[model samples]
Target: MSRIGKKPVSLPSGVTASVDGQTVRAKGPKGELTYVVNDEVLVQLGDDGIKVDPRDTSKDARAKWGMSRTMISNILTGVKDGFEKRLEITGVGYRASMQGSKLQLALGFSHDVLYDVPEGIQISVPKPTEIVIVGIDKQRVGQVAAEIREYRGPEPYKGKGVRYAGEKIVRKEGKKK
Candidate 1:
């Protein structure tokens, strides 16, 4: 028995959800998103929202049960409220800037790194050291943020790099003479 799968997803006001075949679609004021559920799990839309269940009592079915429910919940929430990710640059010369639809990053490299903005995702650089990523799809938003952070991941020694906001990097002590 999966705890998360047992709870039905609740549809908030101004949000509408529907199930068609194996795909679940959600429409809201922000936008619309869809997810195709796996065959190992069963999905249904009810008054409360969406419900998920395992087709059979097996390890694979049980594993997909909770994940399917969470995916459904994510699409509903994403279409309604969307998702956001923030990145902070720590290096002295490292910074970020927006060039129309492109994001330009300077991470102590000999040349600047340019990243092209994808559709349906918005990237903004409020300050040179702050990067904000916003989008209706949670997966896409998170992936973009990860890719940006990968440019200059934080190092333990100096802790100089780009990292997610509020992320704590464990600093390693320098080699003593």
Candidate 2:
């Protein structure tokens, strides 16, 4: 049995959730989100909260049960409080800035790279070396951060590049003369 699936997703204050067939919808002050559960999993809203269970004892059903539960939980949290991701740029001449709806990046490249911010997501630069992304959908916030990081990922040798905030890079030894 999946421990995560066994626990019901408690609704945060100011949040409401409803189940329609295999689709679950959550609405809150932040925003609204919907998730379609797999057929192998069963979802129901009860007094305590939303409950998830495997439709059968098959491997696929068990695997999807936990994932479906987590997805429901994420939507609830997203609609209530939202999600955020932060990135830090470390290197000489490496920085980030906002140009209207685009994110301007100077990651040692010859020309500055411009990333068009997607809808439903907000990007802010508190400092030249810091970038903050906010969105109601947790997956979209993480995906935007990952795409930005991929532009100038940290190198093992000097660990100079863009990385997630609080991320640790395993530094490699410099060349021995």
Candidate 3:
């Protein structure tokens, strides 16, 4: 049995969840989100909370049981409080700013990198070196942060680039004299 799947996901205050066939939709103060459960799992909304059970006692069904439960929980929490990711730029002349609805990044390139902001996601640059990505969907927030970090990953030698706020870079030894 899946430990996580055994536990139902409870709806917090002001958050509502509905079940429609294999899809589960959640709405809260922040926003609304939906999740389509896998066929190997059974999803239902009960008095306690949202429950996910395996359709059969098979390896694939068990695997999807926990995953489906977690996905439903993520959508519930996401709609309730939202999600955010922070990135820090570490390099000379490397900075970020907001241009209209786009993100302007200057990472020692010949020209500034302009990233068009997508719908339902907000990118904020409080400081030139700090970038905050926020959205109602947890997956989208993380994906956007990863894409931004991909632009200039931190180097091992100088560790100069964009990285997660608390990420640690493994340094490499310099050239021998």
Candidate 4:
């Protein structure tokens, strides 16, 4: 038995969970999220919490059971508290700012890089070097942060670029003269 899959997902006060055929939908204060339940997985909504079960003892069914449980858990958590990703710009003149629905980044490029923020995602620049991304969907928040970080990955030398907050970059030694 999978420990994670066997655990029941506690439902919050304001969150509503519904299972329709192969799709499970969760709605709460933050937002609503839907996930497709795997074929080998079965979901049971109890009075106290939600439970997930595997249809068979096969390997594939066991894997699907875990995955389905995780997906449902994420949806429940996402609609309640949402998700966030923070990025920090490190460099002499590297900075980021928000203009309307776009994020303007100055990452040592000749021209400023403008990244359009998608709907359902919120971008905030608390400081010139700090950026915060917030959204109800975990996948979308992570994707946006990854795309921004990809523009200028952290360098091993000066460590100048975009990276997650508190992330460390190991500096490599330069060639001897």
Candidate 5:
């Protein structure tokens, strides 16, 4: 019943995918990634591409069907082209820099925040106010970006602090007489 699950995930060029029981593995120019499909979902590697379906008619099964399919699709794309996340730092004296494997952030705090970079992920600062994170695993890439943003989340008042690129913050009006 899920439209996204109904459509097979087509294999892109230079990407090879395989299914082993409930696990799906994909290898491409970028790297290799694997995803374990939920038991409520049925996954198969067909000639057309990867096919996902609900194992049962239960609501739980149906809910997992689309999520399992998307996970497989993410692994395929991640191995083929990798993933990138950009963060923008906004505030007075707020900036980011790379100190070897650690990311140094100065967000108006008395002490600078140093975040240790995780394995299989690369972080860079093209500009003082810009941070770039790259990795072959989509989930890890996104998680890293989120952790960085959490350090100094953007406030609605002045929208100051770290934020995702192009993210729209609903600014709130300040107290007035």
Candidate 6:
């Protein structure tokens, strides 16, 4: 038996979960998310909580059984509480601003980089150097933040670029005299 698969998934007050064929759908205050379960895995809604079971006792079946359950649980939590990612600009003149539906980033480049905000995700600029990305889908929020950070990755020497908040950049020693 899988430890994580054996655990019950508690449903929140405003959240609803339903299993349709091989797919599990969760609806909450923020939004709804759907996950497809593997053929070897099965999910059933119980009176107290959700139960996950594997059709076969093979290694792959056991792994999928546990992973599917965890994914469903995360979807429930995400729809209820949402997700957020924060990024910071480190360069002297590098900054970010929200213009209409686009994000304008000045990263010491010849021209400012403009990024269009996708639907369902909200981008905010609390400070010119700080960016906050909010969304119910964890994957989408993370992807957007990563793309922005890739535009100007932190330099090893000066660490002057965009990076995740609270992230540490190791500085390398300069040339020896």
Write down the lDDT that model 5 would get: 0.94
Per lDDT, the best of the predicted structures is 2
How far in Å is the alpha carbon of 136 misplaced in model 4?
0.4
Model 3 TM: 0.98
Give TM-scores for every candidate, taking all chains together and pairing residue i with residue i.
0.98, 0.99, 0.98, 0.96, 0.97, 0.93
Report the error of model 4 at residue 144, Å: 0.7
lDDT of 1 by residue, 108-141 (tens): 9999999999999999999999999999999999
lDDT of 6 at 95: 97
lDDT of each: 0.94, 0.95, 0.94, 0.92, 0.94, 0.92
lDDT of 2 by residue, 1-90 (tens): 999999999989999999999999999998889999999999999999999999999999999999999999999999988999999999
Residue 171 of model 1: what lDDT? Answer: 98
**Model 2, residue 75: C-alpha shift (Å):** 0.6
lDDT (Cα, 0-100) at 33 in candidate 6 = 92
Root-mean-square deviation (CA) per prediction:
0.7, 0.6, 0.7, 1.1, 1.0, 1.4
Q: After superposing candidate 4, which stretches have Cα over 4 Å from the reference?
A: none
Number of colliding residue pairs in each model: 0, 0, 0, 0, 0, 0
User: How many backbone collisions does model 4 have?
Assistant: 0
Global lDDT of model 3 = 0.94
Q: Predicted candidate 2: what Cα RMSD to the true structure?
A: 0.6
List, residue by residue over 1-177, the lDDT tens digit for candidate 3.
889999999999999999999999999999899999999899989999998999999999998999899989999999989999999999999999999999999999999999998899999999999999999888899999999999999999999999999999999999998
- Which lDDT tens digits does candidate 5 get at residues 1-177? 899999999999999998999989999998888898888899888999999999889999999998888888888888888899999999999999999999999999999999999999999999999999999988999999999999999999999999999999999999999
In angstroms, how far off is 162's CA in candidate 4?
Answer: 0.4
The residue pairs that clash in candidate 5, if any, are: none
